[model samples]
Target chain A: MQLADRIEKRRFVGRELLLWLWMESELFDGTLHTEEHGAFGFWLEKQLVLSAESESTSIKAAAPGLGREAKEALLRGQLPERFAVRISKDDEETSLVLTGDTLALRALKLATVLDKKEEAVIGDLVDELAGRTRGRKKKKAESEEDEETPFYERMSKAAEVEALLGTLYRDFLRLRLDARWDAVVVPTMRQWAAGEDVDADAYRAAKRGKSTKGAKGAKAAKGTRK
Target chain B: MSALSGSLSYSRFFVTLQGRDGTIRSAGSAADGSLPRGFLDRSYEKLLHHAMRPLDADEPESERSGWCVLGDPLDVSLPKERVYLEGFVNLGFRTDKWVIPGAMLRTRLRQAELAYREQVGREKLSRRERAELKEVVTRELRKKLVPSTRAVDLTWSLDEGLVRFFSHTASAMLSMVDLFEKTFGAKLVAESPYTLASRLRGEDDPIALDDEALWEALTPTILVPEGDA
Candidate 1:
């Protein structure tokens, strides 16, 4: 097959990725992990859209994925088309709407440390005004650094979030391309979608079973536990 | 969303630099500054060559698109200092389109046709004459109107080989990609499921199977079984 054909055909994988993410988020109680980022709070928020062919369902709520309608849509053969998600690591929290087919991130709100930095800058300025410290050259250099700090912080945080996403995608691919996908993931995913209670430990054990390739899948699955 | 301020929303694209041998490769690490020597200088020159041109009232072209200063679209003076940031090549994609209201055009055309007929002492005009009158009327109307302009911020992270285009609209992305390829001789593969997967798998992984074969054999998971559904 041509490259374009392969890309087009695999576009559905994006929807499946989102579906898998939603299932894992609920089963793991909004905590998902990767080898890189130990465990992060991952959950659907604000909106969730699922569609198949001529029909689509859009749910807007504090937790759209927890609703019965979303599950019903899944049963109707619809997959998540796009959804708003909130991810938190330590004190940092990020939110964005992720489009399934293109995996495009929209309205990405990265956690900002600007307020604290601005406060520190204001304190320094106050000290200078009170004649508590600083020379002209020193003050000039400090102010210049202040001006560039927030931008660098913002870019750095954005990069960190992108890296986190990259690792998550890698983990998903590891399971997706392995025999564990059909043997374990799909059944448990179906159970979760049907509102059936799933034993997280059993699911993890099955995911780490011999069906997976060697020790890599088992090690990654181990990381998923809190 | 603007890159410098306001909300942060963007479409990500991975840059693939093509060599003289027609082979494609992902951009090198930012830490090593792995771009070929003088590549930055060459790219800067190309950026200058393709800088945005404001629409002229007398020009016949209905639309035009090109690059400009990131935050200030009006400033097309892309001095190297303004174009290059710490580790990023930041710029804006500006498009200007002349939009003449259809009703106004029809009205002006009718008036022009009537005046022309009277001047020639003819009650009716031929098809060719009408077409010429319409063109003339459109040009006159265009001169009286301003082109609508839109600017979207785009930042290229030199080290990461990633371009964050602020807008998600298809037309805007198409124009930006076309202009970008022209400005820098590199193909941009937009971030998608397949591309991300392949990239994460390491393009140079020796043990990796052929991507085409692996991806081709894959099928979509059936979330709802036939009997179960």
Candidate 2:
């Protein structure tokens, strides 16, 4: 595919993914559990700007704290395209900005893990990657705990951030590609986003309870939770 | 540079090379450039030339803009599933006007003119003469003036062909992309609303990408009303 075409197509997925995050947060308290990636937390942090896809210029939601009405306006037809998100994994939290149209995540502020004992943990993590590449294993991760060097620590942290971002991306893809996502989850999320009373947990449980549509069984669809 | 200082923000993107099977090996290293040594060091130079720099008075007035790399990589993957590289993009601007404020310059010239007139017994200095004097004064003052610099950090995943740059300003993102592309020799595929459907559904079938109909079947997703598909 042409790079321009992919660039063009990726933003819609980004916007939808962001909408899913907002919906998941408001309804499920910003937490989602799955067998593949386990429980991950996502929350709106700092400044969050939402706009309608129709509006050429997306006005910031100035409806006060949390801006429920502004968020509702999104459900009426306007969908969230850009916002700041706080994603938590393994008890570590990071604040990042997510632009839905292009799916770009900028300014990720992960908890400072350098200079602390946590640095050793990052080293240990990179150590496990020693034998992945064949001839280039020697050129692998640059983390060195014994050195306590700034370069090594930074490398370790970057690796961790990439892994975290990848996990979140995959989790989003899972939700996005699910057969029921368009049919059931989106509609359910619209209600919750619009401030309508709906049992989000129950709805998720029902989703978890059933096999994916069209697919033969839980094993076939990879949708069942442990 | 620490090679790894600190960043409060970053812009994230995916990198996809042209023409490749889905196999993981194709994702490992860039088609060119090694990490840390060749890539990072060279990239540092590329960025500095683009960052803002202090303008000297003797130098003719022009648009003075440049950037630099702050610290080292928080991560580097030479030949692995992916290479994660992060650095701060340091930017600064030294305007002749800002460094040599008109008000300040005028006042200083007034003082110099008085001294010159008192010593030379002159009423008014010619434009060329005044300019020559101000030029010398501006040069002396500007030499001592320091240009203020600001920086934003970025993370790039070579194999995934994605980058996460930390800036919300559209103008900043554009420069980030330009410097990044120049430094890496690779184009960044940004995620936007219009492109979402194509990215996730871009591959109708890895084996059948050549089929024009397959590409047509994948419709890009746009923001529609809740009831609408």
Best by TM-score: 1
lDDT of 1 by residue, A69-113 (tens): 999999989999999999988877788888889988887776653
Q: Model 2: DockQ against the native?
A: 0.21
Q: Which ten residues in a row have the lowest lDDT in candidate 2 chain A?
A: A213-222
Error of 1 at A83 (Å): 0.5
Please tell me which predicted candidate would have the highest lDDT against the true structure: 1
Candidate 2 lDDT tens digits, B1-229:
1224343344445444343353221222344422334554565555545444545556876334334333222122122222223432222211223356778878877888888888888898889888888877777667777544335545454444445555556666676666656655555555553333333332322222122332333333333344653
Cα lDDT of model 2 by residue, A61-175, tens digit: 4212156655655645656666776667786766666676655555544455323334545555567677433323332332332234454454456556655545555555544
TM-score of chain B of each: 0.90, 0.48
Q: Which runs in model 1 stand beyond 4 Å of their true positions?
A: A113-149, A210-226, B29-33, B202-210
- For each candidate, report its DockQ versus the true two-chain complex: 0.34, 0.21
Cα lDDT tens digits, model 1, B1-229, are 5766544788989888876788777775323325778888998888988998988867778899999998788999888888888988889999999899999998889899889989999999999999988778878888898889899999888788888899999999999999999999887888889877766764443324225544565677777867766
